[model samples]
Target: MFTHVDAIAGQLGRGLLLTLAMTALAFTGAVAVGLVVAVLRICPVAPLRAFGAGYVTVFRNIPLLVLLVLFVFGLPDLGLLYPLFATVSTAMALYWAAFVCEVVRSGVRAVPRGQAEAARALGLGFGQCLRHVILPQAVRPMVQPLGSIFIGCALSTSLAAAVGVAELTGQAEFLTLRYDQPLTSFALTTVVYVALTLTSGLVAGRVERKVAVVR
Candidate 1:
C-alpha cells in the first residue's frame, strides 16, 4: 500500500498543481467580475442595477456542473470554442462570480451610511468615493468571505474532471481504477483537499486579525 502511494505520488502532485493553477486563475477572474457586478448592483443607474441583479440571479442559481456541460459540450456547435481547461475555468469563474458579488456587496453595505453621505457631502462622485473611501474600509470585512470563496472555488476545480481535464480528483479516479485501490487513492485526495481548505482558513484568519477594526 505504501509503495503504491509512493509510485503514484508524482502523478498526484501534477494533478494537484493543475488544480491549484485553475483555482487561482478562476478565482482571480471571479473576483474581477464579481467586483464589477457588485458596483453595478449598487450604482445609481437603474438599468445597471437591474443587469447586476439579473446576473447574480442567473449564475447563482445554476448548478456548476450544468454550466460546465453548457460550456464544454454546448458551445462548440455555435462556433464558440475553448480548450478544455480554459472552458472549465470560465465556467468556474462565472459560477463563483455570483457568490463573490454578494459577499462584496454585503461588505459594502456594512459600511456606515455616514461614510458614503460624508463623501458625497464633500462633492465626491460615486466612483471616487467608492474607490478611495468605501472600498478600502469594506475590504477589511471582505477578507474572510473572499477567502471562503477561494476555498469553494478550489473544491469546484474537481468538477473539471467530468470534462476530462485530469485535475486532482480525475487523477485520483485514474489511480483508483488502475490499482484497484479506491481507499488509498481517495484517502490521499481527501487529505490534500483538507490541507488546502485549512490553509485557506488560516490565511483568512491572519488577514482578518491584521485588519481588525479598532473600534
Candidate 2:
C-alpha cells in the first residue's frame, strides 16, 4: 500500500514540476494580456474600450474546461496544431487574463482623479502620466489582489490534466488508478497543493507588506 507511494514518487515529482511550469508560463502570459486589456478598457478611445470589455466578457464567461476542450480538439482541425503544453498554457492564460484585466482596471481606477488632473497640469501626456504617476500609485493596492489572482491561476493549471498534460492532478489520478489507493494518492496530492498555495500566500503577504503605502 505505502509502497505505491514510493513507487510513484518520481512520477509525481515530475508532475509537480510540470504544474509549476504551466502556472508560471500561463500567469506570465495572463499578466501581459491583462495589462494590455486593462489599458484598452481605460483608453480615451471608445472602440478600444468596447473591444476590451468584449474580450473580458467573452473569456471570463466561458468555462475553462469548455475553452480547453475547444482549443485542444477544435484548433487541430483548422491546421493550428500546437504542443499539448502550449495549448493548455495559452488557454489558461486567455481564461485568466480577463480576471487579471479587471483587477488591474480596478487598481488603476482606485487612484484619485485629481492625480490625472495634476499630471495634465504638469504637461504630462496621458501615457506619461499613466506610466510615471498613476501606475505607481495604483500598484500598491493591486499587490494583494494580483497575488490572489496568481494563486488562482496556479490552481487552475490542474485543469490541463483533462487534456493529458500530465501535470500534478493527472499524475495523482494515474497513481490512484494504478494502486487502487485513492485515499493515499489523493491525500498526498492535496497536501502538495495546499503547501504550494500556502507558500504563495505567505510570499504575497510579505510582498504586500513590503510595498505597502504608508499613507
Candidate 3:
C-alpha cells in the first residue's frame, strides 16, 4: 500500500505539471478565441455576427470528449501531426472557447445601450468605444463567471487522460493498476482535484471582491 506511494507521488507530480501546462495554454487560447467570437457576435456586420453565432452553437453543442478524440485520432490523418500534449491542449482550448464566447457575449450584452450611445456622442469610433468604454464596464460584472470558467478549464484537464496525455486522472489510474489499490489511488486523486477546484474558486472570489470594491 504505502510502498507504491513514492511511485504514485512521482506520477502525480508529472500529472499535475502536465495539467498546469495544458490549463495555461488552454486558458490563453480560450480567452483569445472567445474575445474574438464575442466581438464578432456583437459586431455591426450581420454576416460576421451570424458566423459567430454558428460557431458558438456548433462547438457548444458538441461533446468535449468527442472533440478530443477527433483531435487526437483524426488530425494525424489530415497531415497535422500533434503530440499527445499538444493535441489535448488544443482540443481543450477549442472546446472551452465556446463556453467562454457565450460568457463574454452575455457580459457584452449586460452593458447598457446608453454607454455605447454616449461613447458615440463623444466622437469615439466603434472600435474605440468597445476597447475603451464598453468592454471594461461589461467585464467587471463577469469576473465571477469568468473565474468559474477558469476552474472549469482546470477541471477539464482531467479529460486529457482519455487522449493518453497522462494528466492527474491518468496518473491515478496508472497507480491503481500498479498497486492494485483502486480505492486509495482514486481517493487521493479526488481529494487533490477538489482542493485545486476549491482553491480556484476562493482566489476568484477574492479577485471579484477586489474588483467590486474598486467599482
Give the clash count for each candidate: 0, 0, 0
TM-score of each: 0.96, 0.97, 0.95
Candidate 3 or 1, higher TM-score: 1
Best candidate, lDDT-wise? 1
Residue-level lDDT tens digits of model 2 in 4-43: 5566888789999999999999999999999999999998
Model 1 agreement with the true structure over 86-108: per-residue lDDT tens digits: 88998899889999999999999
State residue 153's C-alpha deviation in candidate 3, in Å: 1.5
Indicate the residue-level lDDT of 104 in model 1: 94
Q: What is the C-alpha RMSD of each candidate to the true structure, in Å?
A: 1.1, 1.1, 1.4
Candidate achieving higher TM-score, 2 or 3: 2
Q: C-alpha displacement of 113 in model 3, angstroms? A: 1.3
Relative to the true structure, candidate 2 reaches a TM of 0.97
lDDT of 1: 0.92
* lDDT of candidate 3 over 103-139, digit per residue (tens): 8878878888998999999999889999998888777
Misplaced by over 4 Å in model 1 are 1-6
Worst 10 residues of 3 by lDDT: 206-215
Better of 1 and 2 by lDDT: 1
